[model samples]
Target: MSEPTNLPVDPEPIREILKNHQQQIRLGLRMCAHCGLCADSCFLYRANDRAPEYMPSYKFLNSIGVLFKKKGKVGKPAVEEMGALVFENCVLCTRCYCPFGIDIPALITLGRRACRSQGVFRAYDK
Candidate 1:
């Protein structure tokens, strides 16, 4: 079998998209409860036998919650870390909304938007 090819990941466009939708994203993040309902709804969680990190709320917590707890006073490194979790792991697929009846992908997208506004997303290679 051939080896799997790794595709290039460009964070710039994701950042730009997020930047354009920051307010909506911020509002969505503010409404989450980390209730784990979204986790139950995640395919990743099901496939992985319920790893907490795969849960949508946990992922959101890792991104938005960290920023909120720090009140955006975090350093660049921390921001970058959170951005990776938000942008890389999340597909903005809206799958996690089933359990909680909440729009989690929207929330995640909003968080990404915030990251984009701060120039925290990865730069695309020309």
Candidate 2:
């Protein structure tokens, strides 16, 4: 595995994307309740069977929590990390469901969209 290189670019465009999709992002966050029922539906949790951090709600909370704490003043690095966790790891399969009938995968999709707006999407595969 090689170390990742940071790309040089202004984040203004990315910030605009995030700003444009703010409503959808907020909707996704509002759907979660930290119920933990979705834990069993996660592939990471099922595969490892040891790490609670693999749960979808936990992952979403960590990323979205940063936005809340900072009052939506996140920088590129923060958005990038959130994108990796929510997009790459979770699979966006909608298998994780809460007791209140919340769909975790859908919420993750919203997170990805928010991250994507900030140019936090994965690099193109060559």
Highest-scoring model, TM-score? 2
Question: Residues 1-126, candidate 1, lDDT per residue (tens digit)?
Answer: 111224333445445554565565565666666566666667777887787767788776677556555555555565566677676666677767744355677666656765765566645552
What TM-score does each of the candidates earn?
Answer: 0.61, 0.68
How high is the CA lDDT of each candidate model?
A: 0.61, 0.64
Poorest stretch of ten by lDDT in candidate 2: 1-10
| Model 1 weakest 10-residue run by lDDT | 1-10
Which regions of candidate 1 fall more than 4 Å away from where they truly are? 1-33, 98-100, 122-126
**Deviation in angstroms for 64 in model 1?**
2.0
lDDT of 2 by residue, 72-96 (tens): 5766667777877876677777677
